[model samples]
Target: MTGKERLIELLKLLYAVTDEDHQLSTAEIVTHFAGQGVPTDRSTVKADIDVLNNCGIEILATKGTQIRYYFSDRQFELAELKLLVDAVESSKFITAKKSDVLVKKLMTLAGENSAKELERHLYTAGRIKPENESIFYAVDIIHRAINSERQIAFVYFEYATTKSFVPKHDGEPYIFSPYAMLYNEDKYYVLGYSEQHEKIVTFRVDRMKAPDILDKCIVPRPENFDPVNYTVNIFSMYDGEPYNVTLLCKNELMNYVIDRFGDDVRTEITDEEHFTATVEVSVSQTFFAWVFQFAGGIQITGPAIVKEQFRKMLEEAHN
Candidate 1:
């Protein structure tokens, strides 16, 4: 067989063995490959193993068995596997039947034991409601636009409406260069550069419809454009000016804040019960809305204007 075909067969055998068990002896692997119509020898198998390991397949040799190889920790983590299943279940792009089929295929690759555990976790903790099919279609088009560096036009709605094609009150087409998709609260938001506004903007994926790709390519991303910091600073999916905001969070909320903000957070313990944290982010309606959700546990400590606004909102809500 051709060298490429031989390589494919060797890799397939490796995958099959790894899927069944985390470890396999070199003798086992060689025998397995030989059964698949490939001649296997110690030197040849050793070379193939080296090639696979260099290609990022984690194959570890155990102490007792010079021949045994096992997947490294990087191959799969229980948490990451669970998250993958969760993402698939929550995706709107694929139909239920299609998702089931895909999950089954993934399970085959992961092997039965891992597959069962993944299924258990998914069924217990994972819950997702299906979104409109059109949203999925639009998102697919937007992804293509982003990858191809093209502009896109789409109809977007701010609120729900039953009437179809109401020309005047319906939506207008908007053109933009797609930047990225942000997932928050189990919904997808698209960040893009708006041609009309000459600025960056975010649109809810569900509201977008009938996307058309344009010939124009995206301008180069700014030298300072950082996806992680940009998303965090915006506080929401929408792009805007950023501000450094300080918050007084009770110890109860310390873990929550750290989990949300990660190492980017600057924190100091004020007392046994309270901690002060600072986050550099945009002051947006969404930011305030999030603060409101953590009302009793978190208090805005700086940016007096935002603090006052938040106080007024609380007062108004109580009134």
Candidate 2:
């Protein structure tokens, strides 16, 4: 092999063979080069390593009598890789097949010896993954439309009794201008302007089909629209009319309140045991269910109609 090609291959070999637990001396590196069919001497290998270090490959070396060398300062440390792998495995939007594919790809970022360290973190079993496999591709198409500041068209789907994806609204595609893709509750959702709805809406990416970027320009976003505030309105991804509701919350459950409503929730101390919070939320069955989990620790204290609706929901559940 040529000199430059041998230098490049040496880096690859270092990645394949050297990490903290497994390191190589200059003599050992020369042996590795010979094994790869690129004959080189110990002096040349040492010079190549110096060149690599000058270029900032982060291949570190020990200063002991043996003076072993190893690749360090990777793009992703093992902990970060473990976190990413856990996210992929637990994500409900990514299909099991794609999750496996993504995990495998993430592992490649780690070195040869360190890659095996990540193997024990692979646990994709028993999680409820989406059946749709085209979500990743769908995201790509949506991102293209968003990047070009144009519109996109896609068929939306719903599950039937037989667990098959049947297109919503007679298989007609929805034309939309995607504003942002959101990752919430381990699922992916697209927030955008819907042509048919005449307003911004959110749709699950997995529930979409035939995502294609359109040639037309997107409708300019409304000046007053804030996606961050709008996201709070879609509690649990269920859309409803936004309302500023008051809640009577227990003192100890304040963390849960902030956790759900963000840190900016308006609050007034009600008494020694409870506090009153005025927060805007999209009222839906899902929102009511969330409040129901807190038992009497939380209660709707205002807008008699909303309180009545909660009462009706409780009654309906009771019956």
Instruction: Assess the local accuracy of residue 257 in candidate 1 as a C-alpha lDDT between 0 and 100.
Output: 83
- Taking the tens digit of each residue's C-alpha lDDT, what string does model 2 give over 1-319? 8888998988987887788888999878888777888778867878888999999887888877777888885788889999998888887777888888888888888876777777754556667877777887888888888889989898999999999879987999999989877777766788889988998889988888888988999988899877777786564427877778999999999999998888888999999999999988888898899899997899999788889999999999999
lDDT of 2: 0.84
What is the number of backbone collisions in each predicted candidate, taken in the order shown?
A: 1, 0
Candidate 1 lDDT tens digits, 1-319: 7666776776665555454256677787778767877777788777877887888776667757366765543455657767777767666555566567667766655644466766733442445545345666777888888889888887776633875534222466887788888776667777877776777777777767688999988756777777667666673424444777898898988777877677668999899999999987677666777677886788888989878877887798789
Q: Which stretches of model 2 miss by more than 4 angstroms?
A: 121-126, 160-164, 235-237, 315-319
- Give the best candidate by TM-score: 2
Task: Give the Cα lDDT of each candidate.
Answer: 0.71, 0.84
Best by lDDT: 2
Report the number of backbone clashes for model 1: 1
- Candidate 2: 10-residue stretch with minimal lDDT: 229-238
